[model samples]
Every structure is written in C-alpha cells, then in structure tokens.
Target chain A: MTSHIDTCGLSCPQPVLLFLTALRKTEAKEFDVLVDNEVSRENVTRAAENHGCHVTAHQEGNDVTRLHIAKN
Target chain B: MKSLRNIFVSPAGIILTGAIIGLLAILLQHYGNPGNMGICVVCFNRDIAGGIGLHRASVVQYLRPEIMGMLLGAFVAALFFGDFRARGGSSPITRFLLGVIASIGALVFLGCPWRAILRLAGGDGNALFGFAGIFVGVGIGTLFFRQGFSLGRNTTQHRASGFVMPLIMLALVLLYLLYPPIAGQEKNGVLFYSLKGPGAAHAPFLLSIGIGLLVGFLAQRSRFCTMGAIRDVILFRHWHLALGLAAMLLAALVANVALGSFKPGFEGQPIAHTQSLWNFLGMVTAGLAFALAGGCPGRQIFMAGEGDNDAAVFILGLIVGAALSHNFDMASSPAGIAANGAVAAIGGLVICLLIGITNIRRGA
Candidate 1:
C-alpha cells in the first residue's frame, strides 16, 4: 500500500507535523510526499530517513517537489 | 480578501503592512502611550505580567488588553479563515527554554526586536548598536541552521491542546474587562493599570485591541517574522523576508518623521540604555535565540494563537523569564545593564555558541 502526504503552502514545523501525521497513518511499503519547496522536501526526506525509510526525490518546478520514501 | 491579500501576501506587501502597523503604533503613542513607544511586545508583556501580579514593577504594571486581544483576535481570524489547528509535543521544553533565554536577552537590552526599532525611531542612538548585535546573532544562528541543527520535531496531539494558549488570552481579556482598576488604586483589581511611566501610556483599549487583532490576522496569513527576514537573507540569500523587514524599517522611519517623533540620537531614548557593548550583546543573544527558536516575539505570539502549543510554551517561558529578570536584577535600565549584566551577556553568547555547535551532526 502507498500513502500520500501533502505539505504545500505550509511553513517550518507545519510541514514536519503533517508529514509525521501521514507517517503515523501509514503501514505501507511506500509513501509519497508533495511539498512546494526545496527546504520542506529536504526536511521531509531527512525525517523519513530518520524514521528508517529510503527516499527518492523529484523536482517538478521552482515551487513543487515530490519525495517517494520506501519503508522497510 | 483581495485587498487584504494585496496588503499581506507578497514579501514587500507584508513589510509595508508591518510598517503601517509600526506607524500606527507611533501615532497611538503620540496620542497616549508614553515615551513614544506605540507598540512594544516585551514591555507590554512585562506590563501585562505586572497587571496579573506576576511582578511588582509599579511603573510598568498594566492590564494591557491589547496583548490579550492580539491572541484572541488571531485565534478568531485563524478559525474564520480555516487556519486553526492545535498541535504540539515537539521539543516543547526546549522551545520553552529558548523562550526564556530570548526574553531574558531582550530585557537585558530592555526591548524586543520590535521595540529596538521603535526606540531607534524615537532617536535612541543606542538601538544602532542593538541592530548590529541582532545581525551578528542571526549570523551565528544561520551557521547552525546550515549545519542541519533543529531543536526537535513536534508531534500532533489533541485539538484542545491547541486552545490552551488562546483560552489563556481570553481569560486575560476577561480579567481586564471585569476588574477595572479603581482610579488612584491602579493595582487593586485582578488587573492593574499603570499610573505613570511607559506602562501608563497606551493607545485606547479598543483601538489597541483592534490593531493587535488586525496585525495578528495579517501576520498569520503572510507568515511575517522579523527574525525570519534576517535569517533568510543570511542562510539562503533570500530577499522575500528581507523585503518585508526593510519595509518595516522604512515605514517606521517615515511614520516617525510624519509624527514629528524621529529624534536621531542615542541619548534620551525611552526605555533604552546607552551601554553600546551590552546593547550589541543583548540583541545578539536575542537574535540568536530567535533564530534558533524560529521567529520574533510577535511572530511567536501569533503562532501560539494559531494552535502551535510549542510556540505558546515558548511565550510562557518569555513571561516567566521577564519575571525572573526583574526579580534577580538582571534586566537593564535606561542607564544600562545592571552591575553584572555584562558578564551575563558574555556568558549567554558562549552558551548559545555551545548549543549551536554541539547540536549539529559532527560531519553534517
């Protein structure tokens, strides 16, 4: 199963909080996170790794980025 | 919505709005608030602290409805705009400790980031040193941020947890309204009003409250923060936040001129000190703490209102820190820092540096 988290238009801790919420709801092997900036994507990806996940990132535009994290 | 968005959505727009807010504060001061201080988050909070019997600074005690109103106003606006959501459990303790340190640093210099600007507008030359200190502090914090330093992560909790800070603000408003201080007995009620000094001077209750609400609402929407402005410039070389900050300074400068309040000197400034070294050190500590904590005092208040419980805790820590500053004689005066303030300031910087360096991953 795959779960998705959207952290667009949020700032600082909000994106982190939203990612945490989505992570708690997922028991899936894969997670898709959408963020609107590089900083948020980096933070999210770092957080995922801290929680024992592997991340692959893709940038769509100046303000859009996606991260796919695989859970062990 | 369009007009409001125009005033607050862009970086320049938000800075202009912040400047207007600063100017309004000046006009408000001209009409009533003492010492040309129209809006001061730390001084007002200290006054509020006195009003609630948290301290006994007679000349600085007031049941400032504006402070309470800022939070409540923001709370209402956030709810109406679909922005309210309570969450916390992040390194709440750490954030709170940072708040305490931030407030102590501000009091040691006798003002928060906003008051530092307002003091300068009023011709307090001392603020120039404070401004420099803030830059140095932000520079240090930026280094830590670049190294991947974070206080910790926040976890979601029950919605009621978010309302605690707003509810406390509501309670303050109620205290102000019901326990109207008796004439000549300003300290008799559950709320106190200043009889003299900066605490006595204030914009009309309703006017101050209204402005507080407006600023709170707009700031929440735009994510405006003075520290963030400086930090963005130092860290990512971003100008979005810097534009807002520059706007605030320019607007305030213009407003002071129009109001005949611009003095352009370091001496005879209200609620300010002339010890150049401490002014620089004081703001450096505050700036660094704000950088680590991630917002200015005003921004922290607005964040607290928007259901960020960790922010609220930080604010509470500030209040307590103010009380402690006074009780321990660590706060500064117009004359300057107390006898031992210099030593404390240096100690603070060293401690902050230690925290910054140690918290980063060794290689990262």
Candidate 2:
C-alpha cells in the first residue's frame, strides 16, 4: 500500500523534512505527498530524487500539487 | 481565483514582484536610507541590536521599523492565506549557532545577500568579490545537501506558539511608538538612537515601514529568497528563483541610473570597504551558513513571521550575533575590516562546514 502524507500549508524544509521523516520510518517503497506551493513541490522533488526516489507530480487543485514518490 | 493566484505566484509574477522590490529599495535610498543600503537585513538587525542596548555602537543604533514591518507583513499574509502553522524542534541550538555565524560573515562583508545584489546594482565594484564568494559558498552547501545533510523534522505545535514571533514584532512596533527618536538625542530613557552615521540616516518612518510591509506581503506570497535562488540553480538547474533575482538586479540598476545614484568604483562607495579578499571570504562564510540553515536572513524573518519557531530562533541568533560582532570588533566599516573580523570569518566558515558534516543522516 502507498503511504499518504498531506503537507499542504506547510513551508519549505518542513514539507521536505516530512517527506524525509516518512521515508525514514517506513519500509514501504512508495509515498504520495500533497504540497500546496511551488517551493514545497520543487524542494520535495529534489529531496526525493536525491534519496534515489522517482517523483511524478501533478496539479491537484488550483494551489495544491500531488507527488507520487517511489523508491528506486 | 486560480488566475489571480497565478498572477501572484507564477514565474512572471515573481519577476514583477522582484522588480518592484528592487525599485522600491533604490527609492528608499534616494529618499534618505544610507547609499546602496536601502534594505540590508544584517545591517538593520545590527542596528536594531544596538537600539535595544545589545551593543554599544552608538552610531548604528535605532529600532528599525522595516524589520518589524517585514515580520508583521508576513504574519498577516500567512494568516490571510492560511499558512501559519506553529512548528519547530529541528535542532534549534544548531540553527541558532548557524544564524550567529551567518550574521558574522555578513558583517565582515558588510552586507547580506540582498545587499550584495543591491551594491552591485548601485555600481559598487567591491560587491563583485562578495557575489563570487556567495556562489562558491552555496556550491559547497550543495555538496552537503547531496550527501544527505538534514536538520531533522519539526512537528506541529499549538496555534498560539506560531503567534510568538509576530507578537514580538508588534511589541517592537509599540516600543518604537512609545519612545520615538528625539532630535539630537542618543537615548530617550530606553532604546538607543544614532545621532549620526548610517543609523541616523533613514527615510521617513512611515515610508520605510510601508515599503517593508509591501515587500514582505509580496515575498511571502511569492516565496522570494536570495539564498534559495542560487541554491536551486546550483542543485536542480532550476531558473524560477533566478529570474526573480535577475529582475531585482535589473530593476535596481535602472532605478539607480534614473535617480543619478549609479557610481561605479572600488573606493569611497558609501559604507563599504576596499578589502576585496575579506569581502569574498566573508560572504563565503555567510553563504555556507545560510545554505545550511535553509534560508537567508530575510527568508528567516519571513519564516518566523509565518510561525516557524526554528526560524525565529535563528533570527534571535542574528540579533545576538550582531551584538557580539560590534562588541568584539568583528564587523567591518567603510574604513576597512576590523582586526579580528577576518579571523572570525574563517572560523565561521569552518564551523558551518563542521555543522554540515555532522548533520548528515547517514544511510537514510
């Protein structure tokens, strides 16, 4: 099952850190993160890629972005 | 609604916002702010520190309204936009120490990242060295980031916790009004004032705060950050933030020319020094510290405004660091770098590198 982490309304480094925290705590290979701003989206993507994960992101609503991060 | 948000948050939107801020900065200078220093976070923080008697640098003492305005502006924007969430606990001590080091580095160079760009825009040749130093410093930080440097995680807190920094800003505003600067007076029972020098020079209080609030509101909305601009470009090849930075530079340069304040040279440029080597090393320390801390000084204030306690601690560190800089003679002057400023700059760089190395989450 894919883990879901909602990080909407949080700022940068927070979103990125949440993603990292989720990565650390889980043995699961996939995570779905919801971010609200472009800075958070880009930072989370960079962080996921840095940790050897593939990130596929898509726009959700007007201000929300959802990213599917899978471990490589 | 979507289109309106886009107009405020899109790439073009950010560029326009940057241009506006740049032009306003030069305008602030043209009015009465120190030359080429319309809005320097570090310098202003230093002055604020002195104003509060954290240091005894009489010539640089004043309760700067711009700092309070930025924080209050960001606070209001965060609340209106529903982004204020109280969170911290991610190595607060480490972050605070990094803030100190960052302020020291900035002082040695005599400007933060924004001021360095503004200096260049105003045609100060010495800023070139500072600019090059920031690039190299951020480059080093990128290496740590690639190696998994992390400051850990921050959990959610009580909503009231988020209001602390904003409340402090409001308190400062109250203090400024309660003890307004009296002419020819250095101190008025409480709070210090500079009778002369950069601290004494300022645009009208209302005008300064107004521009500051507007900049903060737009910056919060756009997530405008000087350190992030270079970091994104270096690490991810992203140009979004870089566009904003370039726009600020271009706009500031044009404004300087139009205002007839554009004087390009290495010597006698306002409150800047001619020590090229120290200037480079100074920003190298600042850039590294800023990169490791996750934001520049301005960004930290904005984050604090939005309820990040860790960023708030960093801002406090900057306040204390400014005190230490002047007390220990580690800050530079137009005359040149202090005797111990260069040593402290090197020490700051080493300390930041150590923090970067120690904070890496191995195998995670």
lDDT of each: 0.74, 0.87
Tell me the lDDT of model 2 at B178: 91
**TM-score for each prediction?**
0.83, 0.89
CAPRI band of model 2? incorrect
Error of 2 at B328 (Å): 0.5
Rate residue B42 of model 1 by lDDT: 75
Superposed on all Cα atoms, the candidates' RMSDs to the truth, in angstroms, are 7.2, 4.2
List ranges where model 1 is wrong by over 4 Å.
A1-72, B1-7, B361-364
In lDDT terms, how accurate is model 2? 0.87
- Backbone clash pairs for candidate 2 read none
RMSD (CA, Å), candidate 1 to true, equals: 7.2
| Fraction of native contacts (fnat) of each candidate | 0.00, 0.10
Best by DockQ: 2
Q: Give per-residue CA lDDT, model 1, range B81-121, as digits (tens).
A: 65576767756777777777787788878888887777777
